[model samples]
Structures are given as C-alpha cells and as structure tokens.
Target chain A: MTRDELLTALFPAGCSIQPGGFGTLRGMAELPGTGRVEIIGIEAGTPLGIEGALILSGHVLDLVAAASRAPLLVLVDTAAQEMARREELLGLNEALAHLAKSLALAAETGMFTLGLLYGRAAAGAFIATALSTQMLVALPDAYPSVMDLPSIARVTKLKLETLEALAQTTPIFAPGLEPLFATGAIAEIWPPEALAARLAATLAAPPPRADTRDALGQARGGRKRAHDIAAQVMAQAAAHG
Target chain B: MNAPGMNAQSDYYYEASARERAQGLLDPGSFTEFMGPQSRCLSPHLAQFNLTGAFDDGIIIGAGLLQGMPVYVAAQEGRFMGGAFGELHGAKLVGLLRAAAAHKITAVLLALDTGGVRLQEANAGEMAISEVLRAIVAARRAGVAVIALVGGRAGAFGGGGIIAASCSRIIVSGHGRISVSGPEVIETNKGVEEFDSKDRGLVWRVTGGRSRALLGGADAYVADRISAFRDAALAQIPNAPPFTLESLQAEQARLSQRLAAYGTCRDATEIWRQAGLEPPAPVADLSEADYAGLSRLPEADHDAR
Candidate 1:
C-alpha cells in the first residue's frame, strides 16, 4: 500500500505527514480517543538509510522530550536500509544506533512506544527502528525478514530453489509476517482494516514491557533454543551469585 | 605487551580469539565463562540449514575480575559467522546484560567482534540486540558501568555497532572499525564510486576507530594490543558514571553537534580538518596513543563537562 493510503486508513481523522527524500515520512497525528502522539512512519517503497533514519529518529527524540508525554507510534514499511558507500563511510551503524537509542530513550521516559509493521521490515531497517518498541504489531500483508531469499541465497551460496524449498517447511528461512509471528517477533498479525482500532487499544493501555518473544517462539516451535539459552544464562548467573 | 606468562603472539587484540580476548582482558585466571563452548548452546536456526554452529553461538558471556573488581564479560567470536548474533547468540548477550543489572556487577566489558545481526535469523537477532540495549540501559541505571571494546577482524557493524553505542563507554583499537552497514553492502547498492569496498584504507579512514572517536561515536582509542584495551577498560570501569538524564542530555547535545558539523562531510580528511585537527596522518599509521592524544568530538565543549 502507498504511504498516503496507509496513513489515511490508519488515521482517518487526518494526520500531518510530510514526505522526505528516500521514501521517508515524518509528521505527528493523534491516536484515536487519546491525546496527540508523534508519528515516524516509513512508507513501503522507501529505501531507508543513515540520513533518513537520523531525521526520523531525531523527531522521535524531540517529541519524547517535549512537554506532552504522548505515545510514539513508529510506522514501518521499508524493504531495506540504503546500502550506500557514503552511508557506510559516514557510519550508518551509528545513525541506526542513534535511532535505536532514541526509541529506547522514549521507552525509558515512560512514553508508550508502539510499532506497526505494514510492509517490508527487513534487516537493518527492522533492527534500528521497529524491534525496540514496547509493543510491536504487524499487518497481515507485512513481509518482515532479515534478508530476502535471493540475498540469502547469494550469501549462503545455496540455490534459490533449495532455500525456497526449505522455507516452505521452516519459517526460519521464509519471508512474510507469519514466519515472524511464529518467532514471536511480532506481537500480533492484525488485518489492515482493523489497524486503527488495534492501535487505539494498544495506546490506551500499552502492554507492560517484557521480553517474551523467546517463549512465544518456543511454544510455536520456530525458535527453539533462544528461550532455553537465555534461561541457562540466567540460571548460571544466579548460581555464580 | 603480553600478559604474564602469555606468548607474544597473543599480545595483539586483533589476533586474539573471542575466548582469548575475554580471558586476556580480565585479571589473570579470573575469567569463568558462564556458557563456554562446552555448553553446546548453538544456534538452532543455523542447524536448520545444515550449518555447524558454535557451541557458544559465537558469543562468550561470563563473570570475571577486572583489576580485582568483580565484573561481567561478554566477547563475540568473529570467526564464528563473522561474530553475528543469531537468536541464541543474541539471547546470550541479552541474558548477560540482564544478569549484570540484577547482580549489580561493578562493571561489564563487552568485546564486540561482529558485523551485526545474523541475516539468517534477522528478526530474532534484532530483537535480541534490542533486548541487550534495554538491559544495558538498565545496568547503567543500576550504576553498573558498561564498556565495549571493538578490536576484532569483523570490528562492529550493523546492530552490533548500535549496541556498542548504547554502552556507557566505547573503547576501540586502531585496527577496529565500527559502523552500521558493511562496506560491501554500500558498494553493491551505491556503486563503486560511492564506496569502493576493495579500498581497505578508504574503508578504515571512514569507519575506523580514529574516525569514530573524532566523530564522538567512541569514548577512547587504544592500541591494537590487548593490553592497551585492558588498560583503557580498567581506567574507565572503576568510576564509570551512571546513566542519568543530565548525562543523556549531554550525549544528545554532542550527537546533535556532530550531525551539524559533519553531517554533510563526504571525506574523512575534511572531517578531521573541519574538527580543527591537523591534516591527519594516515589513520592506519596512527598508534592508539597518538590517536588518543588528538582532540576528539571537537564540536562539543569538552571542558564544560
């Protein structure tokens, strides 16, 4: 879906979104039945990178520090982070880190942080912005993964057909919202039509902060070792103490 | 300088393995790995692809003594999948930070040697790193100093770089490079003119320890030797400041000033010049001590702090 269409659907009452270069969108909008909240949404086709991320995350930090403690909603739709020489040279990782830190600071300040993944949330873009939120929801149509199949195939030196066959049985190598949901990376796979309502409910009563994705992944049989590894580390730590 | 009774070959931080790095950084014989390779806690995701996984999932997390002070240590093994964080790898990091916070460990030293989240398990890896960030913040809130040392072949990139930033302090060696995206990724997407991935010198100049320090992204620059890293880590851990609103504000101001000053900069040389430094000696030629002597974060009012 286009940025305008998604924003309109999500905020029917109207939102103030301004498009920046490289598919970046910035602005603020009020949550349904709640006070004004800050919005940093990246349209689906946008190729997010260091410069765009800095602008988006800067706004988040500004809004969080503002007098109003309105919740912050991060709209994700980017396919990948811009892989440019200038960005890497300029320390894209640091820019991405800045974004993560901003979101983290927002959560630390007791501001409600919600992420709505509506499109392709892949790799670095997903890590920098979306994953840090207190509550993260994905639309059914969202394609969230680290790297796409072709890229994965290239990196692993495996045939695309082989990876595709593997993805069919294991969500581990699959691309889409369902596989992500199986891993518990996504809190819910809400339909596009119900996004606004779901968001409203989320903002009204933000879920308590906890890292339960590991357990959820275990229960779903997608990520078997994460929970157990974390448990072992904790247990060992306790034992040492 | 080699540690007492250690071979000279192990002196270099870049040459050390993740386990060796962890053991060498801590006081002699003080390192007790929590889930060492013996634990067999490998990445299940890699197993699905029929790939052999490291027993510790590429990261070593445990408790140890730094200068006789109780501390926690976590080091990433770059040889294992470029030290990437898969689900299990990332979980171990998050678990370590969380434990450090709970135990109120006096300090936590992280030896970062990854290119960021493992692409195979991207979402879970990202989530794990995010959890680690939260835990780092929590540890800092509880007065536990969190320091990151980046000096491995992979350096620190992608989510790893971000995680390093979130730490209370960052120490980098001359050979270490830290950035979000790798050079090859940039070259593939932006064309060779944008960033020639083959030009190692150019890559280092742009994202190397010297540039990161000058850019206000790193706190200290040390020699490529493990002893230097240990010394720098020791110097900072004892009195590492708590993460407070005021300190965060100061950091925010510093970062903002960096963007304002060098946001438009394309060349690392120009950045150094603009930051009021002399035409920099080749970044590769500068010793850690020499780099440390140079002014860092020139845009910020360091004296005020």
Candidate 2:
C-alpha cells in the first residue's frame, strides 16, 4: 500500500504527516475518540543513514520536549542501516541507541508507543527502531531480516539449496514477516483493511509494562527455550536477591 | 584486537575466559553464578547446523558483589563462536537483566565480547537483542546502573555495539572496539578500499576503545587489566543516574553535536586531528600511560580487586 493510503486508512479523520529533509515522516494524526497522536517514521524503501536516523530521533525528542503525552505511532519502512564506513566511523550504533533510548524515555514518561512496520527492516536498524517500540504491529508488507540466508550459507559452508531446505523446517533464521511473527517479535499481523478501527482498539488497550515476546514466541512454537531459560535464570537470581 | 602497545605490566583481560573475567572482576568469593557451566544452557539451534556449542552458550551471568555491594554481571566468551548471541546466549542475558530489574540490583556489569548474532539462530539472536535492550532500559529505570566493560578480543560489533551503547556507562581498553559494522564485515561486504580489515591499525583507529573514548561514545578508557576495569566500574556504577528524559535530551544534543562536528570525516585520524588528539605517532602506538595522559585518564592503581 502507498503511504497516503496507509495513513488515510489509519486516520479516517486525517493525518498531517509531511516529509522531512531526508524522507523522514513527521507530523500528527487526529484519531477519532482517543485524541491526536504524534507520528515519526522513516520513508519507505530508503536506506536509513546517519542523517535520516538523527532526524527521526529529533522528532522523538520533539515529542518529549512538548511534554506530549500522546501515543507515538512510528511508521517504519527502511532498507536498514546504511552500509558505509562513514556511517560507522560517525557512530551509527550509538545514534541508533540514542533513538531507542529516546523512545524508551517516551514510554517511561507514560506515553503509549507503537510501531507499524510496513516495509523491509534489517539488522541494527530494525533492532533500534521498530523493535524498540512498546508494541510492534507488522503490516502485511513487513519483511524483517537479520543476516540473510546467503551469508549464512557462505559462512557455514552449506549450499544455498541446502539452506533453503532447512529454512522450510525452521523459522528461527529465515527472513519473512511470518517467521518474525512466530518469534513474537511482531505482536500482530495487521492487514490493511479496517486500519482505523484496529488502531483505535490497540490504542485503547493498556500499555505494556514489560517485554513479553519471549513468552509469546514459546506459545507460537517458533521459540521454545527462550522463555523457560529466562525464567530459570530469573528464578535463580530471585532466590539470591 | 589488542593494540600493539598493550603492556605486560597487567594481566591481559583480552585473553581471559568469560568465567575468569567474571570472577576476577568482582569481590572474591562473592560471585555466585545463576547458570554455572553445569547448567549447560547450550544453544539448541547450533546443533541443527551441525556445530558444537558450549555448555554455557559463551556467556556467564549471575549475581556478584563489588566491595560488598550486590550487582548482576554477564561475561561473554569471545573464543566460543566469537561470543555471538545465539538463542540461548541471548536468553541468558535477557533473563539476567529481567532479574536485575526485578531485584533492584545495584548494577549490571556486562563484559561484552561479541561480534553480534550467530547465523545459526540469527532471528532469535536479533529478537534477543531487542529484548536485552528493553531490559537494560528497564533496569536503569529501576535505578540499577547498567555498565559495560569492553576489552575482549571479539570487541563488540553489530548488535553487540548497540547493546554496549544502551548501558548507562561503558569502560573500554585500547584493545576494545565498538561499531555496528566492524572492519571485517565492512570489508567483506563492501571492499578493501571501503575498509581494509587487514589494516589492523586503521581498524583500531576507527572502532577501537581509544577512539570511542575520545568521541564520547564510552564513559571510561582504562588499561587492559582486569583490575582497571573493576576500578572504573566501581567508580561509575553507584553514581550513574537513573535513565531520565533530561539525560536523554542531553545525550541527544551530545550526539547531534558529534554529527555536526565530525559528520563529514571519512577517517578516524581526521576526526582525532579535528579534536586535536592526533598523537605524534599512530594512535595505536601511544603507550597506555601516554594515551591516558592524552585522554586525561589518571594512572590506574593495581590490586583494586
């Protein structure tokens, strides 16, 4: 779906998002019955370099500076972090962390936050943005990948065909929305239909106070050991504390 | 990844095992591992790839004391899978951080030594990184200081770099490095011209601990000694503030200033020169004491542990 169509569907009342200097989406939307929510996003199908990431972060800080208690709707669509020496030399890792920490501060300050990932997201870009949100809803178009299968094949000395066969049996390392869904990284697989009502419903729900994807992953059968192992450690640490 | 100037005056933290680092950094007899080696929290996914996994999944997590104050700690073994975060390795850290938040531990010391995700369970490892970031924020919000000590051979790349940045403070030795795309990954994907991974000096100058410290990416720069890290952690943890909006704003400005100042530079040497920190020799060749002097770091006293 096009950006306008997605925004219009979510905000039947209409949104005022505008493209920033580098393709970052910013502005606010009037959500019926619940009030206005601020928006921050990376434009679809673009690599998120240092400049774009900083602009995205600037929007997050703007919300905080306004003392805005409105929910933050992060529209994510990126080809992931820009792969360049200058980006890393300038500390892309720290910049991404700054963005995530800004969002965390927004959440801790009592504002509800959610990310609508509607395009491909890879590696550090995905981790520090879409995954940093309080809730992540994957649109039908969402495609999240870590290290790709090709790279894995090369590193492991396994044939590409063999890797494909193994991918069918395990979603743990594959690159698809459903695989991410099974891991509970994407809280819900959101269809383009009825976007307005669905968002309103999600906004009305109580905010999450703890990260629960591990439990969700276990229930979905994509990941079984994470929750149990975390619990075991928590239990043991609790005993000593 | 240790710099050539690394001194023999100190026991090399770069060569220590995960457990050895953990035990040596904390109070004697005060470290009680939650999932010791016997727990054998092996990565279930590695076996699917026909790879052997370690009993502890290359991370050591547990409660320990620093001069009698209780804290939580995680030490990653750089030798095993280059300390990559497989499903189980990541889970162990997530669990430890969750416990740190729940118990209001004084601090969470992460001896990070990772090159990021293990390809065998890449998705799980990625998700685990997200969880770990959230838990670190939570722990800091609960007034628990999250500290990272970096000096291991693997030198914290990719997701590992992000995790290290999320902590309240970072202590780095000249041997340590932090970056999303390390030299090897950059060179492999891009080209030798983009980043010559074989140019070890350039690699350190770009991503090494000295560079991070100079750029304000790290809180402390120390000797490659376990005692130096212990002392720095001791100094920073109790004093680190709870994660706050003001602090975030301050950080935002610091980062923006960083961009405005060094954004166009294509090399770390240019960056250091702009900052007026270009040593007479290769930054890597500066002695620990001389570099520390350049960095305004006081001489570290021995036997702090």
**Winning model by lDDT:** 2
Per-residue lDDT tens digits of candidate 1, residues B1-305? 33821333567789888888888888888888998878788777786667888888899899987777889999999998999888889889888888888888998999999988776776677667777877887888788999999989999987788788778788887778898767887777678988888998888888888777776667777878788888988877755655654554555556556667776777788777776786457756876567667776564223111
Q: lDDT of all the models against the reference?
A: 0.77, 0.84
i-RMSD values for every candidate model:
2.4, 2.5
Model 2's alpha-carbon lDDT is 0.84
Top model number, DockQ = 2
Candidate 2 ranges with C-alpha deviation above 4 Å: B1-10, B295-305
Q: For model 1, how does the per-residue alpha-carbon lDDT over A77-134 read when each residue is reduced to its tens digit?
A: 8877777655665667666766776777777777788888888877778877777787
Per-model TM against the reference: 0.92, 0.95
Q: How large is the C-alpha RMSD of every model relative to the true structure?
A: 2.7, 4.2
